[model samples]
Target: MFVWHGRLYVVRQVLNSWSERVPWWRSTVQPDPPVGAVPERGDHRVWRVEASPGRALGTATYDLACVPPPPLAGHLRPTWTLIRVAD
Candidate 1:
């Protein structure tokens, strides 16, 4: 399950998934994280899935991403990102 815009969506089928490594050197936003840092400020796993809000009949294609997040208060809070949506 994933939440977007405060709506919870359940993945019905995973259409595709892959890993991506961002060339941090080519980034214009900000510098990459320190050495050994996870996610590298760009690397992430993406999944294209068929999903819907709360088991609704209407479904949409959703591009989701997962990354190894940085530590927070000495703990890790792994989160997901809803990259795209197409009904």
Candidate 2:
């Protein structure tokens, strides 16, 4: 569930989804570790979902991402973000 432009939108279906590896070596984003933790597996998982704002004509597609915590870091939780919306 989410709100876009003051209208509430509920995710009705997930059309597609995938994961993208985070190139930490090529970017300034540093992986959190205790100095000897194994390298992270990859980056966030992306999801393409179809949502509706209570109307059939108001249906739209949106992209969401969920970033998992680093390896061995059980104290942290995955973070979700709304990446984009298709018109």
Candidate 3:
């Protein structure tokens, strides 16, 4: 999720395909007592994305990834290569 004006905004595509990965260190050995949190290994995150198809000209669908987070209250930019239209 990207923070804009301190508000969180998630990508549509990623939200649609939202996922998460838990830590594996805990499973490999004893849990760390310092942190005191049983690491649920392989626990994936859930995404709640909101995408606007055809928000712009020549844009049909926008593929959201984990790189280059959304701008903070500046502008909602879409990845040129990742943006696509459903066939």
TM-score of each: 0.69, 0.64, 0.23
TM-score (C-alpha) between model 2 and the true structure: 0.64
Q: Tens digit of lDDT per residue, candidate 1, span 2-76? A: 888898888889999998876656676666657765544467898999998875468889998787776552576
Q: Indicate the worst ten consecutive residues by lDDT in candidate 1.
A: 70-79
lDDT per residue as tens, model 2, 1-87: 777779788999999999877776744566465665444556789999999888666778999888887766898777677889897
Model 1: how far residue 8 lies from native, Å: 1.1
Identify the leading candidate in terms of TM-score. 1
Among all windows of 10 consecutive residues in model 3, the one with the lowest summed lDDT is 78-87
- By TM-score, rank the candidates, best first: 1, 2, 3
Q: What TM-score does prediction 3 earn? A: 0.23
**Alpha carbon lDDT of each predicted model:** 0.77, 0.79, 0.39
Write one digit per residue (lDDT tens) for candidate 3, span 14-84. 43655445346655786443553222335443433454433452322344333222345245333222322
For candidate 3, give the lDDT of residue 55: 42
Worst 10 residues of 2 by lDDT: 31-40
Error of 3 at 69 (Å): 27
